[model samples]
Target chain A: MFIQQLINGLTLGSIYALIALGYTMVYGVLLMINFAHSEIFMIGAYIGLWALTAIPAFASFTITGFIITFLVVLLFSGLLAVSVEKLAYKPLRQAPRLSPLISAIGVSIVLQNLIMLFVSNQSMPLPEFKTTRYQIFSAEVDTLQIFIFCFSIALMLLLNLFISKTKFGKAMRATAHSHSVSQLMGINSSSMIAMVFFIGGALGGIAGMLNGMYYGSIKYNMGFFPGIKAFTAAVLGGIGNVKGAMLGGFLLGLIETFSAGYISSQNKDVITFCVLILMLVFKPTGILGENVTEKV
Target chain B: MYKLISVLFLGLILIAGCAKQDKNVIKVALAGPLTGDIAAMGQGMKKAIEIAVEEANQSGVLKDKKFQAVIFDDRADPKEAVSVANQIVSDPQIYGIVGHLNSGCSIPASQIYAKYNLVIITPASTNPKLTQQGLKNVFRVCTTDDVQGSAAANYVIDKLKIKNVSIIHDKTPYGQGIAENFKATFENRKDKVLSYDGINTGDKDFKALLTKIKTFKPQLIYFGGVYSEYGLLSKQAKELGLNAVFFSDDGSSSPEYIKIAGSASEGNYVSMIGIPPAKLKKAKAFLDTFASKYPGTDLQPYDTYTYETSKILIDAIVKTNMDKSKIADYLATVKFDGILGITSFDANGDTLNKSISIYKAKNGKFEYCE
Candidate 1:
């Protein structure tokens, strides 16, 4: 029981970490939380639902087909994030910091309602994927859990490499350090911001697709709770620190799972938040602490 | 300016005077969660009331007056239901209310309606305390959870011969009430209850909870919640290899549950308040009328009850000349013969129709078993 719950927690933690990276990236680059990012995640799940059910090419549940669908969803989600940044957040970039945050919220509500109006407000089932379970010393682990864990870990590693080694990533880090100064040094801060949003949204979309596959269902507002939790994870790791967001996401997922498994399911959420509060009070800088130039 | 003020005052007086004499439209409020996850049930209730009102108006039941339905969305939340009840009471044109699908919502909303002496005829709420509050103006056309829960317990104990069981509830008044009643009855029969747990309504992840339950290795598991949570529980239970028999109450007696649970829903037992519509000969007319009026739409479990509740409220209004208190009095003694059979209210305002039927999920649908 303990081993199975730990596996479940790790799977959930991977999803939260993927989503938290999005929040941390956006905050790192633009210094503003993209509240609508959750809705972007929701849209990706809907797209996955549509593709698997409506499109014949992606109808079957094969590993290759699933990867193709993820890639397609990732691209669309990234572009959608860019558009949201341009339309909602870009205009308010020069205004008060609070204005963009409020605008992001407005964008979130608009996206949620639009999906409700166009798609559906009710929960819709995703096609089931029968997973094979392996028993290891009286504990069971499924193929889907292993896949999610590995996929998310690979993506995080890739993201880490890109930020540390790539030129575009250096420009983004420079932009985060001083937006005006980066522009003076021939870096297009606007494009860098858009790129950060694209990367964040892409990660969120993958997380959304994984979540839908894990749960076997999707709804218009399915992203709300996960979005809030990922935000908590990002904060716990350190708002602008990439590595910290990943660490916090896993820690929060483990805490929620163990508390729910051992203590009580009803109090898991309460305990998760309590841990966040404690972390904020004692280690306000977070586990990894915010980076200066490498905020992205 | 003085002439304008005087003319405006005259216009206001004319409007108030017209309001006093304009009693041709008799309105009743239908409140429920019309826009959320449970909107399927809410929309079905709306359709049932609309059909009842259409039939009543066509028959000229009120002589010169016509029936009108004023609808509000409570989102199945108790707080929203209370505000909806207050809104309905503020409108003097509304003669009565036929609403509030969830027992949690109905219980709170009924208190507000009772304060204003406005009659509320609930079509679906089954918590015993809804009527046990002794609110004279509150009545229901469906049976209570105490009756439904005990009937389910009897079936599990006598028919299935299940000895040890585990129970879970959504923690709302309706879910918790039914769960407690089931536990009480099961324990009275000296059967072992392995465990009892509570889950939040909108939670999707239940692997941890199910993993914990798997340790008990019970014979059956009973869930006291609506389809939204129960369906997920069913799916997750299968994923975790917890092969216990799944049992639930009327809350999971919807097509949505089958859809959400998919193949995992097979062989699960669910109990509903009344007989299945297809099997009940008395429901033929109601079903036919609904089909003819709203093609390609599904009738929720509560639709028949809501339709009956609407008819009873309309009948009471016709019998009492739209006097709210008199309508309440009429409902208490009224013997309504409708889709659910002869329905009348006890002193506590609970329905006399205590029959419940069980169904098993076969293939992809809930087939009537009893």
Candidate 2:
């Protein structure tokens, strides 16, 4: 039972981590929270659900087909994120810091409503994954769970490598440190911001697809709560810290699953938020966050 | 001389307005969750109400008096329901209210309706306490949960012969109240309950609770919640290999449930409070009339209930003038043999007909079961 619960937590944590990566990356580069990021995630899920209809044979539950559809959704979502950044956030970039944040909120409302107008609130059912479950000492783990965990971990590792090893990565780091100085060094900060958004949006897209597959249902507002939870995870790990976001996501997932399993599912949310509050009070910098002064 | 002429003109205008009162316009308010989570139910009911009003107008049921529906979205919230009730109360044109679908909203809004002496006939609110409160103006066309729950329990015991059952509720008045009734009925019937738990509305994940429930090894799982969660639960339960038959109330007997649950919804029993349109001999023609009028609207069960409720109110007004006490008296005694078949109010303003219709999801739709 404990092992099963752990697996459940891991599956949920992986998705949270995937989404939290988006929040952490966007914040790291732009120093602004993309409140509409969740809507982008929801749109990705909606597109993926539509794409499933085009591939009727895949509706019988083929793993390869699902992966292909996921890639397409990822690319679509990345492009959507870039366009949104250009339209809404870019104009507010030179304005006050609070201006972009407020703009992000407005973008969120617009995106959510637009999607709600297009898509029904009722969930759309997905194909079944009748993949075999391997039982280990009275605990069972299914193929989909394994895929979600491994796929997210692989993506996170790739993201980490890209950030550390690439020349563009150095340019991104340069901009994050000092935006005007990085521009003086002949790096277009705007393009770097767009690239970061693309990567983050792709991760969120994958998370949304995986979530839709796991739940066998997708709704317009499905991404909102997960988006909020992932944001909490990002803050808990240390906002603007990628590794911290990953850690926080897993920690949040584990806490939620364990609490729901042992204590009460009804109070698990309360517990998750309480832990976050305590973490903020005790270690405001997050687990992997460096000691940095808050900017006025 | 000019001032005297103006005074005479004003007096003539007043007399003309009194004569114009011949064309009576009675506003009937239908308040529910029109645009929120339960908007499907609300929108469906609205369409049904519209169909009823359209037919009434076309047939000239009240040749001189016109029935106009004033719709409001209560969003299934009690506070919003009170506000809707207050709005309806202020409107002198509003003669009666057709709904506040959810018990959470209706139970609170019933007070305002009673206070304002506005006759309310709920098509869906089934909490027993709503009608039992001695509210004169409060009435319903649907059977209460107390009776529906017992019928469900009997079906489970006699028909399915399920010995051990576990109960789950969404913790709202409609869900919790029905689950409590089911529990009481189970006790009365001497059936065994392995475990009972509550889940919140809009909950997606049920693995934690289901896993906990699996330990009990219940033969049947009774979920007193709406269809949104019901579909997800069906799918999740299948994934977890729980293998227990899912039992639910009328809330789950929607096409949306089958749409979301897919194959998992197969064999699950959903208990509706009244007979379905196909089975109801008189309602079949009414349903056909509605469907032909509104091809876009899927004929959900609530449509029939709402249609019948509207007819009852209209017929009452048609028989008696738009008087609250007169309408209440008419509703209390009148045997309304509408499309729903013999809807009459009991002493406490509850529906006299308390038949439960059980349905099984087969081939992606809820089919009636004996």
Candidate 3:
């Protein structure tokens, strides 16, 4: 039972980690939280739905259609995220930090209303994905759970590779460490920021797709709860630390599942939040986060 | 320019005066949770009312009179319900109301509706206290939690012959009331209630309660909660390797539960008011019409109720000679054969006879349990 909950927690945590990456990545470079990231996540789910419904190839392939639909949705979502940053976030980059944050909130509201205008506020039906369960000594696990955990780990590994091996990744790290120094080093900080948003948005899109598939339905406002939880996960793992966000997501997911199982199921949210509050009060740097010293 | 402006202003005044004098149209207000967690029910209700109004208008039951339904989305909040009620009351054209879905919202909103002397027929609000206030204007088409609770308890005790049961509630007015009523009914039948507890609505975990429940070795667990918590509870219970009959109330009517819990929802029973969409003959027609009108939308619970409420309201309006003052009196005596069933308001304007249907999840579908 414990192992089963652990697996379920990890699967859920992976999706949160994917979303949290978007938040932490953007914050790492811009020092601004994109409040509209949740909306981006929501749009991704809609795009996935649209792709599945509109594409003839995907429509006919009932069993394997979801995987194809997910990829198409992820691509579109990444493009949308990049475009949003270029149009909405880029113009306000030179302005005060508060300006971008406010604009992000405005963008979030607009996207939500736009969804309401187009999609019925009702929950959309998800294309069925058959999941086979494998029982192992009092624990029954499903294929979807394994897929989620493996896919998330692979994405994170690839992301780590991109950040470490690629020029853009180095530029991002440099920009995060010191923007002026990175600029002096001839890195295009603005373009790097855009790239960060693109990467984060792509991962967020994947997370959105996985969430819809896992939950078997999607709502226009579904992004709010999971997005907030992912943000909390990012903070828990260690904001600005790539590995920390992943750790935080899994940790939170495990904590939530266990809490739901052993503690009062009704107070699961309370328990999760309490853990976050305790962490913040005690170990502010988080499990994998480095304690930073400010020299004035 | 000034002379033209003066002429335009005079024309507007004349039009306004003429519009005010014309009493050919009557408006009915529909208030419910349209944009929150329970937004689906509100939307279903709204769609039903829309269809009912359209059918009534087409039927031309009221000679030379038009009926309009003004919808107010309360988002299931009591505070918003009051504001919505006030808005509905201020509108002189509105003769009747058909909403405030949640009991918490309905209880407070009913006062304002009653004070304004507007007859409010709730299609979905099922709390007993909603009508027990003895408010003349407040009427409900659906049976209250009292009937539903007793029905579920009786089923568990008589049919299932379950000796030990665990009762869990979501801690809301509807959930807690249903739980308490069920507990009383079960206790009355000499059935042992192994455990009784309350949980928050949005809670995702149930292992602790399940652990306790497992230890108690109850044959059945009755959850008085909405679909959201029930889905997770069902899933977690299965994951924890606990096999027991899980039952929920009307709030778990949504197909979303099956989607969320997957195979885990199998064998779980949900007792709900009115016939499920699959069983209602008129519901099929409504579904067809709704599908054609609003394509690619999932059918939701309370859609038939809303349709019936609107039909009843229109029937009352037509019978009352289009007089807003007499509409409430007419509604009290009106018998409406609507999409759900033949709905008639008693002295308290509550539906006289209503049946609760039990649906069991089987093979990833909600199959009607006989």
Candidate 4:
């Protein structure tokens, strides 16, 4: 029973970590929380649902079909974020902090309602994917869970490497550190910001598709809960730090799962937020967050 | 620019004045969730009420007064329902109301209706507390959840002979009330209730909850929620290899449940209030009219009930001469023979013609089982 709950926790944690990375990355660069990030995730799931169902060749689950879905969702969701940044966030970059926050919220509402109005107001069922279970000792784990866990880890690793080893990543890090200094050093700060939004949006989009595939259903407002949870994870791990976001997400997921399994499912949400509050009260800088000074 | 603006404002005022002066029109308000997850059910109710109003107006139930339906979308939220109730009460033209598909909405909304002497006949809301509020103006066409829960328990214990049962409720007044009743009756019969848990209304993930249920190895898993959640619960339970017989209340009896659950819904049982619309012999005319009017829309489980409730309210209004308080008084002793057979309210304003029919899901359709 413990092992099965752990597996469930880990599967949920992976998706959270994926979405948390988007939150962390955007915060890292823009110093702004993209509240609409969740809607972008939702759009990805809808697009993925559309591709899997509308396209006859990809009607059923296949490796190639999923790969195509991943690419399409990744591209569209990333583009959506880029455009949102350009239209809403970019203009507000020079404005007060609250302005961008309100703008982000407005964008979120618009996106949610647009999907609800145009796409579907009903809960849409994802195309069935055959999952094979393997029994390990007394616990059972399915292929889908394993796939979600592995894919998430691989993406996280790739992101870590990209941030550490790549030149664009180095430029992004420098820009996040000191925007004016990086600009003086001849880096295109706006392009770097756009790139950050794209990568984060892409990751969030993929997470959304994975979430839909895992749950077997999607709704317009489906992103709200997971989005809030992922944001909490991002804050718990240190909002501006990538590694912290990943760690915080897994910890939150495991905590939520174990509590639901052993304690009570009804109170699990209460426990999750309680933990977040305790973390904030004691360690506001977060587990991986450094005491960095804010530039005014 | 000022001249044009004043002209537009005057035109709006004129239209409003004309609408208010229409004395022969008696508006019957219909309030329910017209836009959310349970919209299909609400839309069916609206269509049924519309048909009732059309027929009532054409037949000249009142020689000079004509019936008009004022629709309000409460979105199944309790707060929204209260606001809708307030809106209905403020309007003097609205003589009575047929509404509130959810018990959570209806219970709170019914209070405001009673305060203003506005009569309301809920087509669906099954929570017993709704009628138990002792509100003179509140009534329901269908049975309450206490009856529904006991009937479900009896069916499971005597007919299916189920022993180890697990119950999951959506934590709303409707879901939790019915679940508690079921647990009470089932325990009275000495059946072990493995677990009784609550889940939020809009939550999609239940694997963590289901995984916990798997350890108990319950023989029957009964969910007291709407199709949206129940469908996911059944589908996820199947995926987790939990070999328990799935059962739910009327919320899961809709075709949407099968569509969402896919093949996982097969052989699952759902307890429905009254008879299924297609099999309702008394409602043949109502069904025929509904078919011609809505065209391509399926008849929801409560559509016939809404039709009956609407007809009852209309009859009461006509007899009372469009007096709101008189209509409320008239409805208490009123007995109308119509669809669902002899529609009449008890002392508490609950319908006397009440029965729960069971159905099994097969081939993506709910087939009547008993």
Candidate 5:
């Protein structure tokens, strides 16, 4: 039972971690929480759905078709995220932090309504994927679960490599420390910010696709809770720390699952939130988070 | 100066005269979670009322008098519901109301509606407390959770011959109410309910619950909640290798469930009031009209209820003399032949007789079992 919950928690947490990475990355660079990040996730699912359903080449759920559909969704979602940043957030970057936050909210509302207008407000069902099961010790797991877990880990590892072993990653870290200093250090600050959003959006898109595949449906408003939870995960993991987000995601998922099991299931959200609050109150910097001294 | 004086004098007279005429349009307020997690249900309720008014006007109902529907979206929040109720009561044109879907929303909102003498006919609100309060104006077209809960329990035990059962709920009024009802009925029949638990509506992880359910070795599991959780629960249960048959109430009757649960939705049973759209004779025409109007969008479970509620309201209006007070009296006596079945309000304004249907998901489609 514990192992099963851990697997379930890890699967859910990884998705939240993927989404949280976007939120934390953008925040690290721009100092603005991209409220519209959730909408990007929503749009990704819709784009994938449209591709799978409307595009003749991508109609089947074959591995090749799925891969093609995934790439298309990622590309479209990345472009959508970049456009939103350029139109909504870029103009207000120099303004007060609150201004960008408000604009992000506006962008969120706009994207949600726009999606509702284009895709029916109703939930769109995904085409059924073939199911294959494997038994591990006492646990029986399906192919889908294994796929989600492996995919999320692979994506995170790729992200880690891109951040640690790449020039752009160093620029992103420099920007996170101080944007003005990064600008002086010859980093194209605005473009870096845009790149941050692009990467975040791409990951978000993948998460959305995985979510749609896992849940077998997606809706216009499906992003809200997951977005909030991912944000919570990021905050719990130390907002600017990428690895922190992953840890927080899995931890929160486990807490929610077990609480639903032993405690009241209805109190799952309350338990998750309470854990978040406790962590913030005590550890402050999260499990793998760096403890930054506050300048008075 | 002479032109200005005449314009001001005419505006004053027009404002006073228009106010009196505005009172003539009988406004029926329909409040629901029009834009939230359960917005689909709210939208269905609102659309049904609109269709009812259009049909009523065309049929020369209420002696050629046009009835207007005042809509307010509560977003399915209880606090918002109270404020919407207040807004409804302040408008004198609103002689009647048609919603406030969830029981949590309805309980607070209905108190205000009751105090204001507003006749409320909830098309889909099924919490027993909504009508059990003995509020004169409060009524519902669908049966309560008590009836639904018992029916589900009886079916599982007597029909399926399931001995040990695990029950789960979202812990909201609707979820917990139905769960309790099922638990009571199952216990009464000397059947063992292995475990009863509650889960948050928004939380998706249910592997732990499934794990515990697996240990209990129950043949059946009952969930009293909406489709959002139902889909996740079904998928997660299958993933955790729990093979117990899942059963749910009307809340899980939407096509979205199959979408969320995928092939795991197959063979799961859902009991709901009224027949599925595929089985309903009247539903075919509605579907044709809806498909033509909306195009490609499928109808939700409450769509038929909304259509029937609207028909009943308009039928009552047609029987009345265009007087708001008289219409409420007429509604109590109205024998409405609607899309679902013949509906008539008893003395307490509750529907006299209604039937429930059990549907099974087969190959990603909902098939009527009986």
Candidate 6:
């Protein structure tokens, strides 16, 4: 039972990591929390649902089908993120902090309602992706769990390489440190900002699609709670730090599933948020957050 | 500034002047969850009421009065139900109301209806407290959860011969009320309940809870919740190899439940307060007419009750002077044998001779189990 719970935790955690990376990446680059990223996750999930329903060859579970779904969701989400940043966030780039925050919230509402109006408000049971369970060490683990863990890890590693080993990655880091400084260093800061939004959106989108596949259901407001939890993961790991976000997502997921299994199932959500509150209060800089002086 | 103010004042006057009123129109409101998870049930009820009204209007029940069906989507929320109740009450043209399904919504909204002397006949809400609150303005065509719960318990314990039964509710009034009633019946009969628990509405994940239930090794898992929650619960339980015989309440008697739960829902039982639509011999013509008129709408059990309720209200309006108190008084004493096999309400506004029909899921459909 405990091992089974851990598998559930790992599957849930990896999805959270996918979304948390988005929140962390956006905060990393623009020093702005893209609140609408969760809605982008929802859009991706809807797209994944439609895709599943449309494709006859991918009716049941296959690794190739899953890969196709992930890639499709990733591309669409990246494009959506870039478009959102260009239209809503860029206009308020020089405004007060509250202004951009309000704009992000507006974007979130518009996206959620638009989907509600066009698609359905009910929970859509995504087309089944069947997999056989294997008995291992007094526990049963399924192919879906294994796939989620590996896929999330692979994406995270790919993202790490992109950020560290590529010129675009260096520009993103440099911009995060100080936007004007990176601009002076000949980086097209606007396009760099858009790129950061795209990557964050893409990761969050894939996370949403993965979430639909994992749970077998998706609703209009499905992203709200996971979005808050992922944001909590971002904060717990260190808001501006990508590595911290990944660690925080897994830790939170494990904590949630174990507590639900061992403790009260109804109060699992309460316990999760309590952990977030305690971490926020005790370690404000998060596990990997570094202190930096203001450049005023 | 003076010219702009004059323009705004003229626009307000124009809006006020355009408010249309027809003296011969008799409006009856139908409020329920037109959107959200349980939308299919609400929409089914709506179509039945609309059909009932259209037939009556064409037949000239009131001779000169033309009936208009006013619909409102309360989304099965208590707060929204109250707001909808208030909205319909404020509309003086509305003669009666047919619903606000889901007892959680109907119970709260019933208070506001009583205050304004508005008549509301709920077709599907089964919570016992709804009619027991002594609200004369409120009536229901279906049996209460107390009756339903007892029937289901008797069927499970005595007939099915299930001993170690587990009870789970969705924590809402509709879910929790029926669950409590089921537990009460079990306690009276001295039947063993292995475990009793609750889950929140909108909860899709049930693996953690299912894993916990596995330790108990319950012979029967009786869930008092709607289809959306139970669909996931049953599927997850199957996935975890719990292997318990599943029993659900009327809340999960829909074909959608089987579709959502897939192969896992096969051979499960669902107990509803009334006989299954397929079994109602008197309702076959009504069902055929409904299906022919509305090509795609599934003729569900609640649609029968809604059809009966609409006919009753229309019949009452034809006799009464379009007064709320008169209609209420008439409804209390009225006896009719229509779609639901001799419909009549007791002093508490609950239907007399309540019967619970059991259904078994097979081949992605709910089949009546006689």
User: Quick one: best TM-score, which candidate?
Assistant: 4
Pairs with backbone N, CA or C atoms under 3 Å apart (clashes), candidate 2: none
Clashing residue pairs, backbone N/CA/C < 3 A, model 1: none
**Per-prediction TM-score:** 0.95, 0.91, 0.84, 0.96, 0.90, 0.93
lDDT of every predicted structure (CA atoms) = 0.89, 0.84, 0.81, 0.89, 0.81, 0.84
On residues B160-252, what C-alpha lDDT tens digit does candidate 6 reach at each position? Answer: 898888888888899889989988998789888988877767755667677777878898898898988888888888777788988888888
lDDT of 2 by residue, A1-296 (tens): 78878887889899999999899888887889999888888888887887788778657557787777888899999998999899999988889999989888998888877876777755677666676888876666788889999999999998887877888877777777778998999999889889988988888988888888888888877888899999999999999888888998999889988888788776788888999999889988787778332110
Off by over 4 Å in 5: A291-296, B1-24, B274-300, B318-320, B326-347
Query: Which 10 consecutive residues of model 5 chain B have the lowest summed lDDT?
Result: B314-323
| DockQ, all candidates in order | 0.62, 0.40, 0.23, 0.67, 0.48, 0.47
Q: Write one digit per residue (lDDT tens) for candidate 3, span A1-296.
A: 56666766777788889999898888787788888898888888888878877888787656688678878877888887788888788899789989999988888888888897788676676676666878776566778778888989999999998887887788888888878998999998878877888888888988888787766667778888788898899889878778888889888888887787667666778999999999988888776677331100
lDDT of 3 at A82: 82
| Candidate 1 residue A4 C-alpha distance from true site, Å | 0.3
Angstrom error at residue B342, model 1 = 1.1
lDDT (tens digit, per residue) of candidate 1 on A103-181:
9999999999999889887888889887898886666778888999999999999999998899998998899888999
Tens-digit per-residue lDDT, B1-370, candidate 1: 9999999999999999897557798998899888877888998999999988999999998888999988899999888888888888998888999989999899889999888899999989989888888789999877789998889999999999999999999988899899999999999999999999888877778888888988999999999989988889998888788899999999789988988898999999999998788877888888999999899887788998888889888988998887776888888899987777898888988887878999999999898888
lDDT of 4 by residue, B260-296 (tens): 8888999899999997777778889988888888788
Question: Which candidate, 3 or 5, would have the higher TM-score against the true structure?
Answer: 5
Residues A1-296, model 4: lDDT tens digits: 88888998899999999999989889988888889999999999999988888888777667898789889999999999999999999998889989999999999999999999998887888877888999876677889899999999999999888888899888989888889999999999999999999999999999999999888888898889899999999999988999999998898889888888888888889988898889999999788887343110
- Model 2 scores a C-alpha lDDT of 0.84
Model 2 agreement with the true structure over B282-363: per-residue lDDT tens digits? 8877778877887876777588899899989988887876676688888889998887778788899988877888999888
